[model samples]
Target: NRADGFASDSVTVLDPAAGTLTFLSEAAKLAVEEFVSRYGEGGKENFIKEHILKNFYAFELMMAPYTVGHLKMSFLLEELGYRLQDDDRFKLYLTNTLEMEELAQTELPGMASLSEESHLAGKVKKEQPVLVILGNPPYSGVSANRGKWIDDLLKKGYTRSDGYKDDGYYQIDRKPLGERNPKWLQDDYVKFVRFAQWKIDQAGEGVLGFITNHGYLDNPTFRGMRQSLLNSFNEIYILDLHGNSLKKEKCPDGSKDENVFDIQQGVAIALFIKKKGEKKDCKVYHSEIWGLREEKKYDWLLKNDIKTTDWRKLSPKSEFYLLVHRDESFLRSYEKYLKITEAFPLNSVGIVTSRDSFVIDSDKEALKRRIRMFRDEKMPDELVKQTFNLKDKSNWKLKVVREKVRKDEHWEDSITKILYRPFDIQWVFYHDNLIERPRKEVMRHMMEENLGLVSVRQVAEGIFNHAFVTDNIIESRVTLSNKGIAFLFPLYLYSDTDKKETGNPNKKRSLGSTMMLFEPKAEYTIKKPNLSPQLVERLTCQYKKTPSPEEIFYYIYAVLYSNIYRTKYAEFLKIDFPKIPFTKDYKLFSKVAEYGKRLVDLHLLKSVELDSPVAKFQGDGDERVEKLRYDGGEKCVYVNRSRYFEGITKEVWEYQIGGYQVCSKWLKDRKGRRLFLDDIKHYCKIVTSLQKTMEIQKVIDNIYPEAEKETIEFENK
Candidate 1:
């Protein structure tokens, strides 16, 4: 069974037990002792004793039988001529690969004073020279491997500690990553990679290969990890298999692309090689494989080796050492513009109500009734959950919600309007205690009549189209697709003011005020514009005029809607918040601001231009939406088998905002519900608004080139 002229002792078969009967059975079938006992020359037992048993060494550590029956079955196979017997060379111990260093230091009870297998594994891990480490480790975001040894190793090399404090981790270059959430770095696959890297570093030189999630390739959060790998290895090879369905990825030729595995997240095979000397400057080579899973992915992997496949040399830069290609020229220009976050100093993510089913509803009365039931002490939690079809999550438990609600005396006052989706307004029970994440810091500004810009920080769908204006409280995903959360940047901030007695009792408070004192005294909340004073001053100096906050807000909105701006800097917009390039020309700024104001009014559905409808509701039925379909030839949208909206154009019907087909989504969300006269008129106005928006966008695009020609550059201070 041995190689020609090679001793059996030269090769050792070592594997961790899979804790399955199938693994044991397969191991017995493949053993050389079984072969010698079955068909060797002379007596079978004597031949195995003389040759097979004396030379062959196979150890299965971490042996764990699922049941007593499985344990008995293993012994039965050994008794029935399987020749599976434990000698000095064959020992089993319960060991975890990630914690070999800790396990090697501890002693475990066994037939002798200590487990020989444990001792050997410890010795191999601490003292042996491992030249190669390769495997497809498990991928779990909520990894179960939280041992102190592995966590310490990760802190030392790959990621920041739990408190997010930098403790001399080699992964960080000079500055902290400044990430609020880096939980993805704790994935089981990442831990395994870190472990392998540590082992190779201990040995001073080795090769590490693994197939893992491709998120780290360009994800802004993994800059440190990418830098750490670059610092440790001499050469790195990456074969990205782009097939992320969540991002709705497509091949270069617009063909359908699928993942090699049945997972929404894409994967890549990464190879890291370290030389046996001082670490050299790292050279990274990258390649991509796309198309069908079997033909393109599997066939290519089966056919090509590292030397055979083509690779493109990449030069990763500082700050964010992204693995993917970037347009350096475009990025250099884009970086000069003022970021939205810098322009607006105060902003926050929108409200996240974990129990959306129970807390939010289109009908205000229905929401009121649900709240009444929730506040009722007599109503059992289970019954209340059943009534609202509420499913308790780990964060939003019924018991906790009931206790919070029971203590609040003014829970009814928390009911308010929310922009649930694009052009879809709904009432939400907005209580900090009841809702999972109310985002009170920013949302309090929108409690009354206030304006806020809704946009996502990152674009995973390869587009920068999710931007809108809201005048009310917004849900976390109000206008987002692809699991992206929307952030709200309110134009003004509100704070409580002391109640002062006014002479007039019947005088109405200002439109934006939320609280009022009763009995002849009125209280008005103070409102302050949430704009950076320094930015305003810089723009004022550049334009020779002090621009109002509303003017700046509208100008930003117009810039975001420009087709040229979106297309030219699409890659830059994908990584972070959109930046606004201020035009030094006052005329261009005024024109763009005028258009932005019109768009804002149109989106809010308060524009005088919307008095005229482009589409008309025809046909007579129950007015209930059963299904929605559009006919291009007829230029009509059918709500059911009978009723349809006429005079609708194909462009208007297929219009999208925030990754949602507007005309269809509005109707689809109202399925099986009767549409009133106001609802019918509203749909027509929405169609008109979309048509106007498309026309306005083209107008902005025409003047965008002139606007970009003379831009204001702000000082770093």
Candidate 2:
């Protein structure tokens, strides 16, 4: 599958302008075509002996592909009129490349005898495998076994022994691992990379090139790997081909985008070269190929010397997009603000009920999660029949959950429950979990206005509409839905989980959103600390001389809801939690806090009441919908929809929030997995319309001006 340099330009009578197409895969064709077009010279026979057969190599795990690979090379040779020798010494091997080397070196647990060729492949390490290691590795699931050698790789944690020596010019952020270390170093592609790096290290001077997942280039999780490459490789090139659903990025030029392969995630081509010498003062050359047709992408790769371009000449060390942040206030806030972890270190996603049918049903007389289900809130008969084997289908087995004592257990009533769902850039809280039907009048009002939560109806195209289609796809996947019938998973947190769940407190308190900060109590301890507890404290106290969490959250909220933050920090927010910006001025803090509180209220539906004219409900039984109307029904929240749609009052579903399946923000995340309707409880969305959000942003901007562009600009030098 990692075949390279096989592009065919054979022409025919049909479609004369573009020429005829070859049946060969791009990689196979590129391998042959690139050689003929760029480097083929002199007699073909001698070249085959010295270069093609000797230097060219292919490693495959399966015999089928291995045979196909051999045939491909042979076919290409024959096309050049070179007859194949009987026992051609093609480097292709029918063995699993992942473990062959290690298995050959030393016996690991479950170690088995190896064939002569496998042993030889393993022995190549001592002989120096190659000066240039290149291939496309598998990118499916992670390795099930993290054998001893792999564990060592994870713990080794730095540049290879033969690295190009660190010069600090091409470095990435590094801190001692206590916690928060990237856990994905074991991913298949990363391991292949690790293997490639090892080969180069053994050779002392070599090139490691491959087309693989582009995530390692910028994802915070792969920082150490990046740093290792920076320290070890003298020269590097990264050509990011943005197509993965995880990125949710469009073609930069507005062209239709699809993954470069059958896979849903984006891919990149990286070439790392190191010569045995002193460290060179160079950054990795990085370029991007976005939204091009499949043929054009392959053509570009074939035509370009990926290593010779200016990559990081633009934004070498900045976060994705190479944009720098120079806001003094932001810098100050980051420097001084206390992190949220200091206060409420405890945090977790809302509760996940693994078996909903067995733990819940609709009858108020029936117990679900130790509480009786409100009679009107009964699950559909079809849903119950599909999932549970109940006595008359009225009973559920909840004792295992309700009776089991766990660390964060809470009393039924006191438990903090929220329909916590991410809506695009915001975490939309749509309902409270009380397991009871709302008052009829209130339900009617909300349903009519499309503002209040209704009985869960997960059937798509019923209430919420599709958020957005990936490329041209419009189908929905059902297996991953929450209730096996509906798609939603309410956030569950116990009252006892009160001590943690912290935020970063900053001095720029003039802006605010869902963020808030409080001081670390003497009794507070770190929960799920990504950084060491010691570093957490140091980082939490870095900026302010005498740090205080005073009104920190409000300022964060203000910034979060600000147009500037959303528009600028859009990329950062997708992969990581909000790192709020704070300010020291109390006046600015309070003003921003006010806006945050208003947003909080607006989302909580505090402005409207049960009897308010805007509150309304509709339908009966399954087809029911709820709403909250304003501006004479011109604005509303369709509390129950596959996702919000459009119209002044139409609420469109946004798949980008929470990276959830309902949002479809990252299709590559759980590729081929189903999305439970129960997990998508907040199909609910709110908006008077698109312009209203913008106008609201304007109000915020007027209250406190955003940092001007001049304030953040920096010269390339």
Candidate 3:
């Protein structure tokens, strides 16, 4: 009843209502009962005369809810033997709390009629800052039609004329400082949190309580929001509900996979309070609850143990302060010793095609079929008959992309093409030169779609696959976060920016989870480094006097892939780039790098190299292994780990039906069947690679060591 220390003296209880009075009624009922319990209702007989008229208040944007809430509050008072009259100073009114203008109508998204509202039917002017500010806020992401009042609070500290500003308002986590300007703060719930703080800030002392998207607790993007909370509130309480399917983040406890809310994302209850004249550093308490339903969590909150700790123990000034930890000493050691930004100074989010169906695909043949379908239904010859040319390469984006075919000329001129994905109905672009194969063979075997996208292809054992192809390639991969391609892909690639000539690579891209290597910079629409030769050599070169790029790359890579790094830094791996730990000892670092090189060689070893030791091994699969793939013909690789080629972990076949999970597209027929020669080869590579990677952790442990995690072993009493 007294959450945030509500008392008889707290004459104002306000909810910037989301069209509900249910909470207000509960609060009133609690306030009346508590008053009776504590003071035995010394003189007051009616609840409204004693409590409701002066203390209860709410503001809503919609008229329907406002009216219903007003009536509900009146009836609730009546039920308690106190009837609310017309002049009883009914505090519930139609208003947009975010945009608390002098007027309430003509504001609120699509609620133009709520303009005629003031303090309790213009009864009480709330000049004093409220003692308690509380409610659940909407968690929708920022939109084109989002509230301007909220947007200003997100982009800047103050909204319109409400000039409450905090120094921590604009903080974005950085690699080279401001490298990652995260927009996740634009989420709706963040704005509400800020708004609550603003209300408290204006009052100079008050409590702000909210049940919200738990991302604010640990998402690196919301660090600024957390910072504001620290600056404003001296005492904070965080109750985490760990079930986020949007992130597919499971509860730390063994609860059901589903979250408390209907939505897929996780939720949390946070209470922030700062009393008048309190300016000392904030003290924070953290706890967690988990279950399939909201009621299960509620039951635990009231009846069970609350595992909590001092917030300072999490190291608030650290890069990811929201992580739960007993101590951050080892992490501090890694921070002082190693840094990833020294090598890779830039990164970016992968391309977002707004239209996925026409642009993205697992099967290139299927993509071509889409093109053919469009051609048959809507092609006009006049639009295709005209030959087009442009002087500026920039203008080429507006025209079309052409797939490289055997002949330069087109038999497709009459095939009706206003716009198609750079290919004729019958033609297929060979990702590699087609001098070796039939057009039909290229179409059937080589996976190529949309002119430059090549999904897969297999060839001779001696020949390199995908090592030499060029032409504005975009290896759109998000496997890093999913745990699949994260370890397998190179932190830096030794790509031939210029074909047929190879040495130290002139170009490189860091492909990994949580890292945004240089963003789309050039005409190719791919992220590139500042084009500094030193950066390229550092990540791509295999040999140098000392601290070679290959050595640093592998050293960092090996450290990143280890379970030590994963377990110790689990919180950071979410929504953040790697903050790599580096070493000054060339001898120790080089040895680790050597191991990294072996893994790299194994990972990049083309499936075409059939007889090579790396490509000849085989393994087995069973019911536990739900998905596996291997090319039935010549020299193809097998993936026994993930249901999808891009995903990291293995799971049941049912995982694919989820919108973004594409495991269903992998070769499912071979899942539980006998392992192929190619399949075993990849598994062997993973096992061998992991064995080598573990060495780096040991090497690092020898120097800037990790704290031995306490283990609990149960014995029979």
Best by lDDT: 1
TM-score of model 1 (CA atoms): 0.82
lDDT of 2: 0.41
In model 3, which regions exceed 4 Å deviation? 1-7, 45-47, 101-113, 118-128, 143-145, 158-165, 172-181, 247-258, 292-296, 304-315, 323-327, 360-477, 480-546, 607-665, 668-717
Which 10 consecutive residues of model 2 have the lowest summed lDDT? Answer: 11-20
User: What CA RMSD would you report for each candidate?
Assistant: 7.4, 12.9, 12.2
Assess the local accuracy of residue 614 in candidate 3 as a C-alpha lDDT between 0 and 100. 26
Q: Per-residue alpha-carbon lDDT of model 3 for 517-567, expressed as tens digits? A: 442222322222322344434323323343434455666555554455655
How large an RMSD does model 2 have?
12.9
List, residue by residue over 189-270, the lDDT tens digit for candidate 2: 7877776776666566667767787766655455556666665677777777767764455775656666677776778887
Give TM-scores for every candidate, taking all chains together and pairing residue i with residue i. Answer: 0.82, 0.61, 0.65
lDDT of 3: 0.46
Each model's total of backbone clashes: 0, 105, 15
State the local distance difference test value for candidate 1: 0.73
lDDT of each: 0.73, 0.41, 0.46
lDDT of 1 by residue, 451-480 (tens): 889887778775678889999889988766
